[model samples]
Target: MSTSFAAESALASPADGTARTVIRSAADVSQLVNRGAAVGSDARIVIAIALGGVFLDAYDLGALAFGVKDIAREFSLTPAATGFVASAITFGAIIGAFLGGYLTDKIGRYRVFMADMFFFVVAAIACGLAPNAWVLGGARFVMGLGVGIDLPVAMAFLAEFSRLNGRGNKAARIAMWCPTWYAAISVSYLLVLALYALLPASHSSWLWRLTLGFGALPALVIIAIRSRYISESPVWAANQGDLRGAAQILKRSYGMDVEVDAAALRDTKAPVHKATWSNYGALLRGVYLRRTVLATVIAVASSFAYNAVAFGLPVIISSFLAQSMLTTILASLALNLCFAFVGGLIAVRAVPKVGAWKLTVLGYAFQLAALIGLAVVGRPAGGAQVALAIGFLAVFLLGQGFGPGSHSMTFASLSYPTSLRGVGVGFNQTLMRASSTVSLFLFPVLSAALGTKVFWIIAFAPLAGLVALLAIRWEPSGYDVDAEDFDAAKRT
Candidate 1:
């Protein structure tokens, strides 16, 4: 062996030398990992790569929403055909999320993140060149799969990497993704508007193609940067009997040069046993059971409700602008600018101090009020009421931006142990994406059937969520996030 390899091997924690696994039916996570939780440059590099994936997630998803109209015109789509094309990706996401979550738990995080990027690049290309509505729909579905798979992986990376760095401010980092998502949506909107201005009406198809093609750019950049910045999860590596690989990745990818305290790195205190299925069962028997349930609920609720609005934003705006095309376009653009960009940034700052749960409750409350106002104002009240309804809709969307709107995933992912971290997060992410699928179908039907009054009724969802939050106290604000699943790791 080379001198560097030998040296790294010597420094690796012996306890982590063997893969320490927690089987779904086992209770072995009694204590392990986390002798040192200080921030490493390698962890930061991982963060950079993960963030890149998320940026693409934001960009691709946002691009489609903004490009839908141009695509409709390009393909001469019927309303139903357009809706099918638009919602295709969400359906793909539901499948990708479930499979990704399962694979992430089984295969590991870095592998999945790397694989998903390829999906983004190839799928974006397909979408841009799609010859017909069916083909475009197929491409979008593939793109959705990429987005769905990436979400949990991104969350898992953030959680584990931040834990190593001893930063409980992980929520702050994840919450920032919300605004980045908004920024992505806004960029696509602006890009399409610019394309509209630059291109003649005869070649409008080019505009949509260009916008769709642009989605691939972030993923490509991310893949290249990732070679230098991405590292395997130290916690995950350690659990998988790759201590030396973990350290090497840490040094090279994150540029971490500090000497690892060997004695501290391998805790003699952590329980060790042959891995078994019962380790996972232990998660459900006690304190973990409640946590699992709470996080799952939040995940499901957030995915359903948030996407119901976000993915539906343009369509909703399109409906509102029925007669006046120009006004419709301008108003929709303004809403995105305010809600996705400005409002989301404000939310990022608010999360750390206000706490994710508090913001969630506050966000839900704002949405409820806004929904009621929208319903009442939208009644037989005519154009004046319609104006008020539009105004209130923006307010409600901003409220969504603040709480259950974007940062819900942050809370769910950060609430578990390193051993169960992948699975807990995977399950939550699966459900979250699944909820989005349900909402994608339900939102249009709900809006069309009940009209604006549908919102007032839907507002009750948050009230239920609010009660769950209060009853469960699934808060992650002050928790020593690193030490959380340490116990679970030992038993495993």
Candidate 2:
């Protein structure tokens, strides 16, 4: 678990003394990346654009949070219909993650990354223009598809483009998705607030449409600049026996001017694992099984609790305080920015030092305590009680930001090597989205039936996460997982 930025001798020119750095195999490219990017390289820009995709996923997923009630009222819907509309996007994400994961590995990260942005544009427009419940639900499901597909590719870009461990290591970059996600959620809240204030009293219902539609703006921005800044992962290219293509990408993106070693090129072997349906099964077998199980549990638990509380924050706040829409909006925005967002930033800095495991455990503990306090307090009746209730909510979110929120992706993305990275994230997200669908669809029904007692049920999620972490004791931060790809190649 050491951190360094020096390139290995494997990337040095051969004894014959050629001017260019020589790449003999995929391992050479991986070693170069593990050593860290060259100063002022375009690699950082590629990571930023990849993070833009994560921003879109968060924006679209949370955009509907405040709007769910309006959607239910406009469609004159029952509870079940409202749930369907609310949960449709997650359902779409479930399917999209499964396919997107395989496709990211089967094709290349660049192709998958470029394609999902269009899904956001088309689906956002469709949701805004929908005339009926069915159309709105359908549009959301399509948007969910984009959200689902984007994560696997985005995580892959962050991990592959980053060094193994250091200031901007793989774990830290992957954990960045956490803050970017909260930042997107905060932006959505700000949009909702702006629309709430600006719209005429008679036209206030238009607030939801405008908020949801604004999602396309960032997607379009990413699309326009993608070709200039983004390129296929050099390590992935070398893994595919394309040393020449890999060398070109290294020069363009990594600022490393290297050449394919002619003698080594002649002896290059095929990649150990080709993209195929059977790779999904590989997740459940041998060494991967334990890591896969641990990552899946972490993701499912995190998604279930987060989707229930974060997505339903407005409703929960309004219920506890019985406040006006304006008050609820301001309160939600403040709690997220002050607690959750800041917590994510802390996790990003702390992971490379304390590691993902200890922080996640601490986070789950905070959430567990917060949930129990909320259940015990029920709906606040007095000033002191109300303050306590809000404090509990803040504690829960703070825990989320630093713990599972930041590191769930850490566990999911870093547990496997480049060869299996796509499928690894895909499988984790697929199950995670399923948990989200269940939570989103059931929250209204359960809250209505059980009221504040619902916190008791929600508490189980973090509890399960704690149990899994304790059982596995696996830490992903600062680990050199990409070496697995090269090691498997050597074995074959």
Residue lDDT tens for model 1, 333-377: 788678656656676676667777888878777777776776676
CA lDDT of every candidate: 0.66, 0.89
**Prediction 2 TM-score vs. true:** 0.95
RMSD (Cα, Å) for all candidates, in order, is 6.9, 3.0
Prediction 1 global C-alpha lDDT = 0.66
Candidate 2: residue 393 lDDT (0-100):
96
Candidate 2's clash total is 0
Which regions of candidate 1 deviate over 4 angstroms? 1-45, 66-83, 163-168, 253-285, 318-326, 379-387, 481-484, 489-492
Residue pairs with colliding backbones in model 2 are none
Q: Which candidate should be chosen as best, given lDDT against the real structure?
A: 2
lDDT of 2 by residue, 1-492 (tens): 122222343353568654567777787888888887789899999999999999999999999878888888888999889888888888999999999999999888999999999999999998888899999999999999999999999999999899887788888899999999999999999999989988998987798899889999999999999989999988777777787888898899989878776776778454545689988887887778888999999899998998899888989998878979999999999999999999999998888889999999999999999999999999888999999999999999999999999999999999888888899999999999989888877888899999999999999999999999999999999878877775654212
Off by over 4 Å in 2: 1-7, 10-19, 268-272, 489-492
Q: TM-score winner among the candidates?
A: 2
